[model samples]
Target: MSRIPEIVFVTREEIIDELWNKGIESAFNSNIYAYTWYLDIVSPGWSALITDNYDYLFPLPTKKKYGINYIIQPLYCQQLGLYSSKHITPELVDTFIDNIPSKFKYVNINLNIHNKTDKHKSDTNSRVTYMLDLLNYDDQIFPKYKENTKRNILKAFAKNHTITTSLTPSEFISFYKYNGHIESPAKEIKIIKQLIECLIRQQKLTLLGCINQSNEIGSVALFAENNDTIYYLLGARNKRIKSSSLHFLLDYQIKNRSGLGKTLDFEGSMIPSIAHFFSGFGAKPCKYLNYTKNSIPASDLILRLKKELGL
Candidate 1:
């Protein structure tokens, strides 16, 4: 009989060798969202469950609400769960989930694409994301785009809009604040700025903007890439643009990045129109899991009251 490995909970300062070797060695890279520095920016108080050998890890982004410490998904983090150096089997996922400390009574989070399991199927909901494979050249990849997307790209070009990759982090943040209509807390926006600056320093960030002849910003997007994948982290468009500058901006990236054997992860949209827009670019749906459990009394009722009262 084989013995199951023991898992221990540790605070942010306790991480020793760094998960994924601080995301240096590509051989051990799992997800950029799970990187220690990324977590520090997004969720400063993050902790984790790990084996003694550091083969596997489960990040817990926790917060204290009404004096109750609970796990909640942090802003700007798309997915985080069992990130391991070894094969992430269903059994391994269950083991880490089961070990989540009981102190975190209310749990709601998203697991990465790799953390597949049937054990929590009843409590988990499916979420959709979109990814475009960029293994082929621009000429080959352009044809795969749906007619609607192709038309939009043409429309943008007809308007003489140009794509620029020179937007600074603060500039993007200001654009997002004024034009993006983002509803996240101001503090979260600050965190995003910090994250963007950090990524820039690491040379992992790609900030692109679409500009008109008059040099007005029409659309912009921020992408973070590892060696092989680019995550469309955030984007915004000028509502006044009559043409499809956002589409033009994305198509520019597609053309620039195609033939590089990479993937473009459209971080996601559950809204039908947004999802359709992503699919129009030949992006395929990628499903992840959303797990939620509330053991606290009247939690839902309290949330409902807060929503009703506009709290």
Candidate 2:
């Protein structure tokens, strides 16, 4: 007979050491969001699940709304589910889902790219992110880009748009917000700004901007670095620029970071147009899973009301 792994809920105090230890051993756990300091700032009071030997782990970033406790995917954290040193099986995923404490009443979170599971009762939506392998230098990589992307890069160069890494986090945030890319509320923006500041302090932030010949900022992007991957966290561009300044900016970053053997992760939008834009850069699609469950009696009604109120 085979032994079934026992899953137990761990308090906050136990998280830092164990999670970091496990993360160090697992490539998938290398994300900065899974780190203690990052979580402390972005998702304080978070709980977790772990096996007896601490081989498998899951972080539950919970929040209480309207007196109902639920697990939420925190801002700036891309994926947080099922980090294990051992091979993860469908059975293990199902076990973890089944063992999630009933107190949460509701759950909605995105699993890591490595996670896979058998279909469950709750909704499971598919999400896609884009990634470009940076092993090749510009000489070899540029040809892989779509023709339209190439044209844009050439146009940007002809327009004398220069790429610079001088933008501060606050400046990048302001540009992103004013460009109408992020429609989040003031409170949410505050939280995101705090996260950005924390990442900046940790030396994990990369801010780049494209300046046109007239010395105006035409495009800006903020990348978060962790575990040999540069995540395209946020970006915005001035629509008035007929030149493809944004395209040139991204290409410059990819080329500049190429020899370092990092992957550029376009933490993406399932929205068709955005997906198309990422694809133009020769980025491949990486599909992940978003899991949700509502166990409360009136959970549907509550969710509906929240949506209607834009909460």
How close is every model to the real structure, measured as TM-score?
0.91, 0.89
**Model 1: CA > 4 A from native:** 1-3, 17-29, 299-311
Give the number of the best model, judged by TM-score. Answer: 1
For residues 1-311, could you state the per-residue lDDT of candidate 1 as single tens digits? 23568999998788864544542233243667877788888888888888876777788997876557789998889998887666777777877888988888789999988778778888899999999998675566788899989899898888899988788777888888887757764886788789888898878999999998778999889999976889998888987766698999998898899887899999887989999999989899999999898877687658856876779
Instruction: Please state the error at residue 115 of candidate 1 in Å.
Output: 1.1
Q: Model 1, residue 243: what's the lDDT?
A: 62
Q: What are the runs in model 2 whose C-alpha is more than 4 Å off?
A: 17-25, 119-122, 239-242, 299-311
Structure candidate 2, residue pairs in collision: none
